[model samples]
Target: MAHPDARGNPCSSSSLPAREAAEQALWRLMSFYDTPLADLDAAMAADPAWALPHVMKAGFLLSLTEPTLAREADAHLSHARALARHATPRERAHLQAVQLVLEGRWHAACRVWDELLIEHPRDALALQWVQLWDFYRGDAHGLRARPARVLPAWDEADPLYAHVLALHAFGLEENNLYPQAEEAGRRALASNPRVPWAVHAVAHVMEMQGRFEEGSAWLRQHQAQWAEGNGFAGHLWWHKSLFRLEALDIKGVLRLVDAHLSGDALQITLQRVDAAALLWRLHLLGEDVSAHAAGVLADWALGEGCAGDYAFNDVHAVATMVAAGAHGQAEGWVARCAERALGAEDARRTNHLMAREVGLPLMRGLLAFSRGDADEAVDLIYPVRSGAQRFGGSHAQRDLIDQTLLAAAALGQRRALGRALVNERCMAKPVTPLTRHWLEKLALPEAAQA
Candidate 1:
């Protein structure tokens, strides 16, 4: 996509409309995730000097599915950034935030996300920020609290308020308030049947209630519209990825990534909640997601001369450490958390956030399990105490927490922990092969006396 700003008659040469176009392009660009590259190309061809599109296209190229073509897009994005003095505020904000996320500057993104969340409380596009940044940092209490402050009239303001409902519901579920969570999710779906997060919550309720077929079937029914509309097709299965971790459709998840990650010079921006969650799924499935997503994630995590607060910034970092098997990195992440814990306004609040906020504490638990420190592992996530249903995260997201805890219980010889997790009290159904096999082999009579 290439264009020149030639709006004025050279004789009079007033760069007014050209400047206007640049400004318009920026907002359009920020709000324009998931639209196909070809269409964006057509837009650029219609007006070559549009700075925002070029900036966005370049961002997409960096995360391209295909190397050769993405390089071409990169050339154009480089050109767009070069011409950015003429870009609009919205375009600049998005481009900058996008860069932050890509760079993994968690602290920066944390500050920026809070501002954007407040500024665009109901922006259809700001949800992207909510995913990549805010999703990772805060706790369950944070997730469920003060949504009203963000959008007090949220229900009537945007068609996408269903998403907030989904968030609210998931937040409640993470805290073990299943009944409340289910109701929130159902209300969200009721308002907008298309809200994927709402559907995600309902699915969780179904899973806990043992309506597997019904839960499974809803995803199949809405997968297409949800994908095309949100650019986060994988999220449909993301919530279900928990109990069915063994039954996860790895190929399906990859296909969704493949469909979205095409390396066409212009990248299709998708919903942050959808795309980032899909990336996590891909990571869990043991795919080489890091290679393609590292830059894209870094772009979001780092932000441009600013900060953001999306939760996935931290989640993705931990997921990456897991994928890369970087033990030291995990330790450092904990060290950082410890630092944040010290200065945090409320330590209890932060811990509560950790319980469901991407389940990072759970990751620590798993890491402990890996090193044969089962008790430490279990202790790390003990706050995720059974029966505290408000551990608000997607069911699939919460599964990782369960997985780590179950493993820790068995290995640490915490029979009560093991039985509590595998038994019907915690999980509506009995243990699956993966959980059962792993737990049984942990040998509680052995090293674990805690």
Candidate 2:
């Protein structure tokens, strides 16, 4: 007998309880809350033939992006494939999509999901999965536009409608649609205040608009809602730190780092990258945070075996090593990236090109800055500033590269370049004290100062 989920999509689980539990878990994953992996375990134990439960398990594991979890995803894939012979076409399509993900073909998997949605537009699982893959690939347009494509197919009565709205909110923000993004984010939160992604979307709006004090307060007011059992806690904290940095609240930023951002999240690659980024921001601003840098670098040292797999991680690893004064190791990581780019997969080859074209130069520039070669750093970083987004980070994260270039220009007394950059930044935001400070230091035209 064929089973269906709440939306009447074919599922392989005949057990009603198991199907409902798996559906709940999918919603939980979409909300960035801890999933019910144990429930799927129990469902599989009760009915080894239930394919959708295995699909959920495998999908969840693959989404983690932890190298160790990849093996577990493979095991689940084997089980799901064996049982898929008797499952419905929808279940089989999902199984195939997940298999592509397991094989490291992210874009291929996204295409599969896209086709699946064309027929079964209410498949929340596929909708969320594509959004996740889009984020990992840094597809800013896909982030906002994918959800927009499906807007006509969804209504407020749907169980996961708020999740879709939150996803759209983030996509809009990433695409630089701040006003509309905030409207969508607020709507999502009104539906469910616990939607951390919506909160994060609004945070991005405030961050980009230079609403530092308001951004800080927004996160703090909502901290209790998202602080527990949420996978994005560290990331939200990282956003808060950025707000503090902009406000020149060094102590507040350091406290957030010590109190929340620097612990277990370090074990996760993406979160660890956030930690490295925050610490690098502090280092760039001349804050003495050797202890924090040392701890983060030690964590990176432990994960050095996985270097060069992703250009994004490689650059963060370089930041960690450079901050710790491991100049040789930093260069070695860049060399490893060079080797990986040679025969990389189609999905990863773009990242490889990004590493070669922009990441390597930016990293070398950071390294030069660390070694007191500000002139060389400026010479290296200024040329490739426009291409930094190709390296697979958000606008906020890639801003680190530009910040390093500014640092080099300031230190090397490149007055003309520094004045122009400062003026550009000041014009973008109406009330940026930090940029104003730089303007004063440069003794540039007061008309350029905000």
RMSD of 2: 2.4
Give the worst 10-residue stretch by lDDT in candidate 1: 4-13
For every candidate structure, what is the RMSD over all alpha carbons to the true structure, in angstroms?
10.3, 2.4
lDDT score, candidate 2, position 56: 77
Q: Per-residue lDDT for 255-342 in model 1, tens only?
A: 5455543233113222333445555445533467655455444433322211112222344445445444555665666555545534
Window of ten residues with lowest summed lDDT in model 2: 342-351
- The C-alpha TM-scores of every prediction are 0.52, 0.92
Candidate 1 lDDT at 36 equals 44
Top candidate (TM-score)? 2
